[model samples]
Target: MIMIRVILIMLFGRCLSCAICSTFHGWIKKWIQIS
Candidate 1:
């Protein structure tokens, strides 16, 4: 159903961003330490 699909996209989008930000921050920390 449309409602179900919308909910799934919203939940998945947030989760993806949460994961991305953590990885991005981790890499930034490493890069700063190396430099």
Candidate 2:
């Protein structure tokens, strides 16, 4: 689980400046929870 988050961070780290990043992060959290 930690590794998955780490990989996601690496992939999304580049877009941290974007407003949508937070939304995408929330979605990811929800998705993880659902799974």
Candidate 3:
């Protein structure tokens, strides 16, 4: 049970990081377009 919880936490963290990175990339693209 503990191991499963740890795995779930890791997966969630990874997903969150990916989402943040995607958003950051999108912002950069928009900034570049504006510039």
Candidate 4:
């Protein structure tokens, strides 16, 4: 049970990081397009 919880936490962290990275990239792209 503990192992499963740990794996879930890791996956959630990875997904959160990916979402943040995508959002940052999208913002940068918008700024580049506007410039």
Residue-pair clashes per prediction, in order, are 0, 0, 0, 0
Poorly placed runs, candidate 1 (over 4 Å):
1-17
Give me the overall lDDT of model 3: 0.71
Candidate 3 lDDT, 1-35, residue by residue in tens: 99967865776567756876567557768999999
**Candidate number of the best lDDT:** 2
Error of 4 at 5 (Å): 34
Per-residue alpha-carbon lDDT of candidate 1 for residues 1-35, written as tens digits (9 for 90 to 100):
99967865776567756876567557768999999
lDDT of each: 0.71, 0.81, 0.71, 0.71
Once model 3 is optimally superposed onto the true structure by TM-score, how far is the C-alpha of residue 19 displaced, in angstroms?
0.2
What C-alpha root-mean-square deviation, in Å, does candidate 2 show against the real structure? Answer: 4.1
- Candidate 3 local Cα displacement, residue 23, angstroms: 0.3
